[model samples]
Target: MQKLVSEMDNMVLRGEIPQAVAKFFSNSAHTKDVDGSETATKEEAIQKLTGFVGAIAKVNEISLLNSSVGQDVSMSEFRFHFQMEDGSEINWHEVIRRKWKDGQVIDETYFQN
Candidate 1:
């Protein structure tokens, strides 16, 4: 699970969020954002991630600050800096917690710092 979480985080850092979602999320996966918005399935999650990535004009940096993995759960802390298409900047820290089942993420929640 640790390796899996690391790989997924790497993929996201590289702006391969859609691919990461496809590879790591279960078909019935659910995702909740820090804002309390939710995605009920893997397809929705992929679309949401893709849209967010698309809005980024450039990725300044994406750093994995910390991480931990337990039996079926993983948490990763990340810092993101990005330039948006509208010339706005987004710099924030967030922690992603995922619940895994059958080697795929069934639930994911994002907490903003």
Candidate 2:
């Protein structure tokens, strides 16, 4: 599980979010965002991730700050520094909790700091 999460994080850091979602998320996967918005399916999750990645002008930095794996659950903390296409800069820390099944993420939730 640790290796799986590490691979997914590396993909995201490399701006391969859509590919990561396609590879790591289960067909019935769902996700919840910090704003309380939720996605009900893997397709929705993919679209959401693609849209987010599309808005990034450049990735200044992205790094994994911490991570832990336990049974069927894993948590990863990430720091993101980026500039948006609209000229806005974003630098924030976020934690993602994932519930896994059959080596794929079935559920994910994000908490931003």
Candidate 3:
């Protein structure tokens, strides 16, 4: 599980978010905000991730703050620091819980505050 997460982290750092997202998410995967305000199906998630990856100028760093793996779900807390076209730095912090099945993520909830 840690190895998979590391691969995704590296993919993001290399600006390969679409590939990363696709590699771990199932065809019917669903991702939603923790508050249930926003949700993305597998297709939507791919589209959104493409846009996000295309918009990134450079990935400055990825920090794995913590993580825990349960029977069928895993919670990961992490931070992404990146640069925009104008050379501005941004830090995004979030905790994401993912339910896994058949070695792929079937459901994910993102927590941001």
Highest lDDT: give the candidate number.
Answer: 1
Candidate 2 overall lDDT versus native: 0.92
Please write out the lDDT profile of model 3 over residues 13-60, one tens digit for every residue. Answer: 566767877899888888886557544567778887687666779877
Judged by whole-model lDDT over C-alpha atoms, candidate 3 comes out at: 0.76
- For model 1, residues 1-113, the per-residue Cα lDDT tens digits are 77899899999778798999999999999999988899999999999988999999999999889999999999999999999999999998999999999899999999997
- Return the TM-score for candidate 3, rounded to 2 decimals: 0.77
Could you tally the backbone clashes for each prediction? 0, 0, 0
Worst 10 residues of 1 by lDDT: 9-18
As a whole number from 0 to 100, the lDDT of residue 101 in candidate 2 is: 97
Can you list the residue pairs that collide in candidate 2?
none
- Winner by TM-score: 1
Comparing 2 and 3 on TM-score, the stronger one: 2
Cα error, residue 3 of model 2, in Å, equals: 2.0
List candidate 2 stretches off by more than 4 Å.
none
